[model samples]
Target: MIKAIGGYFGLEMSRAESLRYPDAQYFQSARACFYALLIQGKPSKVWLPYYNCDAMLGPLQRMGIDYGFYAIDEDFTISRALRLAPTEWLVYVNYFGLCDRQQAEVLRRFNPAQVVLDHAQAYYSPPVDCLATLYSPRKFFGVPDGGILVSNVRVGSTAADEEASHQRMSHLLKRFATSAEAGYADFQAAEKSLEAFDVSEMSQLSRNLLACADTPTVIEQRNHNFLTLHARLAEHNALAFDPSTLNGPLCYPFLNERNDAVRPDLLGESVYVARYWAECQGRCSPASWEYKLSRLLLPLPCDHRYTDADVQRVITLIEKGLKGD
Candidate 1:
């Protein structure tokens, strides 16, 4: 039989919690938020980082907005800085919640109104003073479907399909009932549904679910989990990031040239890690650091649900992997 460990970490609320107010406006997905903002801003074009998912291209292409790409250093730092004209916007990702507010303050070099910050990985990081800040709660929580957009620009309001969350919840349910492996099909189905995207408000189901969230627990537990895992991996880890930079992290990103071996080693120990992106495999050369890093960088599990034993188990597995056990 398949096994399971953690449950949903989204907002960390229990079943007994009452559904109250959902404090912010939400959308169908981060991509939908991008579409809505594009409609309102009508920018001459957008400047997106070369290190990005092609999903953003969907909305920009649909809107017929002129766009171009820029590059980032291995440290994920902006390789080249540009001050776009008033009619254009620059999109920046806070990466793994490691880019703190002070780091994001660099955008002030451009007009705040021209920046679009993607907090898809930085859910708890507050919105910087930018034209728009897009969030993917599913990236940080157990929610079946939802994305939040905080923007200075105006977009048309649209009521979202309430049933969408139900269609996507099978995997989440199966994970709770049995093991995450049992929910693989539903998870794949949920992922496939994103391409049929639209601009809609967050569903009441999601809003009610979000209302039950315990904000403080979500922040504290995740921060603690990240640090605990980092402490074990820091001396040998490839990320040049400072541990103090973590706020509410998505995962413990571990860099290993042998990620191919590392992944199966952990999986054999019932600890499954994730590959951040598959889109980069063909676009960049295999010999390049970006390509190899993209291919081998393993995002380790350190979400809130894991225990001290769980963390120790991961450390043990990694050590075993390093030793080629």
Candidate 2:
């Protein structure tokens, strides 16, 4: 395939070593990775959480695999008693990366071979000994789409490589050039484009962009920002846990009634707080913990993009908003 030595240059990206999970399988999306695993393993039935987005059930529904919903306690622990047959599996989401200890505890009760670890929110949390552990790198990085699967299941067939991610780069470029609000519509559209994805290998563009990430700095910044938020807002936060325990959390999930009340106002101040799952109401009862979390929980930004001062700004705005100012 080597023909010309040099002619015109393309988009230049860092060749620096990026975060690498050497022992995992890569796919186009977390759903694609899950689909690949299911296509090969062919589990007859699976159990999922009611708190989850409908996207998680795509693979199972596509294959006509039967599944049941389970409930979780306030602490994110499975609340129901479960018994599984030989051909069944359970999928547990590492909610907001704060439930590592709980995840480890849950894995003990089930056969390690029948449990699937959904680390979509827990990217920094390493994969443990399990049947199949799935990670959505796009959730944590700037890459368009990528999924990592660390599993005991053997690969039966290889999916074709994904098409270039240039089309998906519109929102990213738009946001980078201007403001998040300016590109909000493009971002939503880009996300919707992946809704009907099939199993495929990770795109080369995404892989290269992933290689440019500053892993150590990103982890440190996330931890620092999260702790900063927890320090100021822990009293208002309803969810009780040691804030310093998590490695690199997705965000500082400040589960306070005040936080939820001020969420809409914060966006007016250029602080966009995301709801945990807006669509969970259809699948979850109003009295359920998940439904309450959906409405009450505020996932404040504590990622690597902001500084300590930026965090302080958010804290002050939240405090002001809570006072009805």
Candidate 3:
């Protein structure tokens, strides 16, 4: 599974991790706060990455918030956009678990009051000091609906309602029965009725999973799986690491000059690989488009669910595929 899926992926444990409950469902609230802040005193402009989720842009659009796009260099850092304009609000992403402390420092120099750290990808080693930090638990852990937003700023109090709670519990029960697809369907159904302003319930199952998560073990497995993939794929002269000063890589991104030709061959072997971000939806830019097209990011499963053998199988398949044997 590690070989197939890739990245520090894992099945969340049942008991033993910390539980944040109402506070855990912070992403929505943070969005709400941003909206409220804009209404009270709309900033001149906000900045975000061209490569990002459409869901994030929804709130900004609804709030009538104006925004701009920044460029990600070959190193995946925002070095050039710092001097673009006097940014009022900046959304900083910890892309693929690579720490962006230096990027954050640059943003801080411009306007510390307007920076929002989107740690949705770097949940494992999230930053502590930031004006605000938002995370989606579902991406990293097995959760139905929960996100954590931590900040010193005060926002309105609108707790998760009963319907959302029931729906979340239903999803949990369905997931526990090993029907993940069914659970996901149910979640989608619930999302349809959710109001833009309403707060959704945090999944207890997700909280429990986080509390029971083995941090040290997960980290070790992730690093091991990543290193294995790197060692095996590095010999291919055509494949090279996305040059970035990443302390920890959540996914092993490789630049394949012949991706259009080689991708199908790899997939034919039942090695499911992703061509992540084939299309940039939100705020598309020339630099982002160029950066995205030249790369294929592979996630190595380093989560507790994967073992050493899983990593080996993935590498073996890659080696065979590369040889066309």
Candidate 4:
């Protein structure tokens, strides 16, 4: 019954913290923006996180940009002291919307030209003033496909033709009447479709959905749900980040060793937790923290559309996993 009624919705409730981007270009994916920026900058060397997706690195690799990796500390800050030359570029992920104001501000200390803030996990976190910020709207909402990039560098191009997004929305659609599990292939295919796509403007359908979103309500709800879940699970959770730190967190990113046992229970309850990135497996060694984090982290949904009761349900389910039941 749980999977029948509740599983019809997204793995997480799709909500936009806001639709207000004053001057921005919408693309099919964040990678499209990265491609445009790399093309325009023509940087010789690129810096990125060791724990990252191949789609992100694909652009740099294709351009033959001399690339280097940066490491993240336990809390996912820039643990490694890394630097770039005057004409090089750097890209960083603000994991789980937990990057502090100071950490974000430090990027601005560099030439704004060299900094690309990947807010794929953060929607409500304010864009570090005058820095290039990349947002994946699909990650935050029920939209089929779209990415927004706000930057000083402009690539001379308009929205290119795009594959119809309706095909990509099957999971979101099927979940309403069936199980989210049934539509998994549709979701995976939708994501794979974005990789081959180059620079393009946001689709009309995506733009319209974004325009109609109640973003403020979504942000407020996300904050409340995250804090509530954090307060309950913080003692057992191994991550060092604070719950008060989230603006509009993508999810309650609780990292723990027990995730392998807990996930199936949550699935049985129709409570789906996202594996932040499976690509971490193929990219890093088995002993690497990034790889372990990929396998163990539970990105539990604490977005809008869930109430306190729902929060408690998820907590109860998680506790069951901790006990190895």
Candidate with top lDDT is 2
Model 2, 149-237: lDDT tens digits are 89978654355445546677878887888888888887888788778768777777888888887888888999999989988988888
Better of 2 and 3 by lDDT: 2
Better of 2 and 4 by TM-score: 2
Best-to-worst ranking by lDDT: 2, 4, 1, 3
Each candidate's lDDT (Cα)?
0.77, 0.84, 0.57, 0.78
Model 2 error, position 11 (Å): 3.6
For candidate 4, the clash count comes to 3
- Point out the worst 10-residue segment of candidate 1 by lDDT: 15-24
Worst 10 residues of 2 by lDDT: 155-164
Supply the global lDDT for candidate 2.
0.84
Model 4 earns a TM-score of 0.87
TM-score against truth, every candidate: 0.88, 0.94, 0.74, 0.87
Best by TM-score: 2
TM-score ranking from best candidate downward: 2, 1, 4, 3
Q: List the residue pairs that clash in candidate 3.
A: 6-299, 6-300, 6-301, 7-299, 7-300, 7-301, 16-211, 17-211, 17-212, 18-211
Per-residue accuracy of model 1 over 167-192 as CA lDDT, tens digit each:
78889889998998999899989978
lDDT of 4 by residue, 1-325 (tens): 4546643553343435345686787887788877877778788888788787777888888788888887776767665477779878778888877785645555655676687888888876767654478888787877777878888767744664545676677777876678778878888887887788677777866776777678668889999998888888998888866656767888888887888989989888889787767886776778888888888989889988789999999999998899897
Q: What is the lDDT of residue 305 in candidate 1?
A: 84
User: In model 3, where do residues sit more than 4 Å from their true spots?
Assistant: 1-14, 20-42, 84-87, 101-109, 162-201, 236-249, 261-275, 281-295
Kindly indicate the candidate among 1 and 4 with the higher TM-score: 1
